[model samples]
Target: MTETPQVTGRHRELLDQVLDKWSLHVLDRLCEGPLRFNGLRRAIPVVTQKSLTAALRRLERNGMVERVVVSTRPVAVEYRITPLGKTLQDLIDALLLWTADNLPDVERARARFDDASAVAGGE
Candidate 1:
């Protein structure tokens, strides 16, 4: 019997950090061009300020997003995708496509599971 290779802890941690809803949404918005904090907020209107800030900070810490402080009166700052981040674009796109393809089946399975659980509990 052959054993399947398991994902490493480090890889799992990285995926948990990057695959979060806010992080994915932020990355998708930044795919167009650099955006200021306000711009990002506008682009993703439903995200709370705290959530956006945390996501951006995490990305910046991971060296995926570059934060530039422009020398202006109010100290304008902008966030852009780093080279590493650019590399993730295709991976993100592929993941999106995969999710789209699987979502219907996933929903159906969830509904079936829930129905079975309710029936089992009633017995």
Candidate 2:
């Protein structure tokens, strides 16, 4: 049997960082190959420039992403997933599968909750 590790405040903070809104998107896209700033932004259309920048910075700080600068007439910067980041691909895939499998149930649950909230508000 596998043992569960103790969870600490620091662990929660790092978990929050790793699983935030844009982190997975950034990491998953980088998994395909290295992409320049504009390319990454284009891949994730809903993300604002500021949000993507911040997510990239956080991932870089966490040692999960690498930033490389290409020197040309006009310099370019690219981001790639590190070895550590690639390790999470399985987890990401699992999460994607789970969402696909359970989407209908989740939608039903959400509709039920919304209906309950509306009924309560009316009462």
Candidate 3:
């Protein structure tokens, strides 16, 4: 096993922020290309409009995403993953692979734990 480096409190906080529920979903979709607000919402149908807006805003503030304004007839906004965000693609891919590989095991573990808990009257 590889040794893990110690992470400072601030580092952990940032990691949690960047990996928030909606942030990863937004990042994953944005990785494909720049997406308009509605496009992102359509792609990630599970996320609410407010949640996606908040995630995009947080990403833009963190320098991981860029917001562009198009001077069109109706005016348009687009969000794209930045180079900083691109730097995390490898890690993201690894996370995706790990989840895919472990999902079955996770479900089995959950079932076993829940069965044990219910037997003990722990709900």
Candidate 4:
């Protein structure tokens, strides 16, 4: 049996910031290549502008993504995954594959839990 290492507050904070819903989507999109603000919005249609902006700022602060100024004429900007962010690719791919493989089992577990909860209470 492998013991889990201690997760400090800083580690938890970083995970919360980087692994949030919008952050994950933003990171995945940026991984492909550089994209302008509008381009990112279009790529993630469900995210509001405010949410996307916040996610980008958090990613930039974490050094996982970079914002570049492309033009002064139209005030263009683009976001791209930094080398640091690229390091997450293999981990993310493995996680996604794991989820795909285990989703059916997860669904069964959830169904059992839900049935138990319903029998216990309305919640």
Predicted model with the maximum TM-score? 2
User: Per-candidate RMSD vs. true structure?
Assistant: 2.9, 1.4, 2.4, 2.6
What is candidate 3's lDDT per residue for 1-123, written digit by digit as tens?
A: 999888999888789878999998888888889999999989999999889989988889889999999999899998999999988788878888999999999999999999998999964
Candidate achieving the largest lDDT: 2
TM-score of each: 0.89, 0.91, 0.89, 0.88
TM-score for candidate 4? 0.88
Residue pairs in collision within model 2: none
lDDT of 1 by residue, 1-123 (tens): 989868999888888888898999888878779999999999999999999999999999988898999899989999999989888899889989999999999999999999999999999
From the highest TM-score down, the ranking of the candidates is 2, 3, 1, 4
By lDDT, the candidates rank as: 2, 4, 1, 3
**For model 2, what is the alpha-carbon lDDT of residue 72?**
75
What is the alpha-carbon lDDT for the whole of candidate 4?
Answer: 0.92
Question: What TM-score does candidate 2 get on C-alpha atoms?
Answer: 0.91
User: Quick one: RMSD of model 1?
Assistant: 2.9
Return whichever of 2 and 3 wins on TM-score. 2
- For each candidate, how many residue pairs have backbone atoms clashing (under 3 Å)? 0, 0, 0, 0
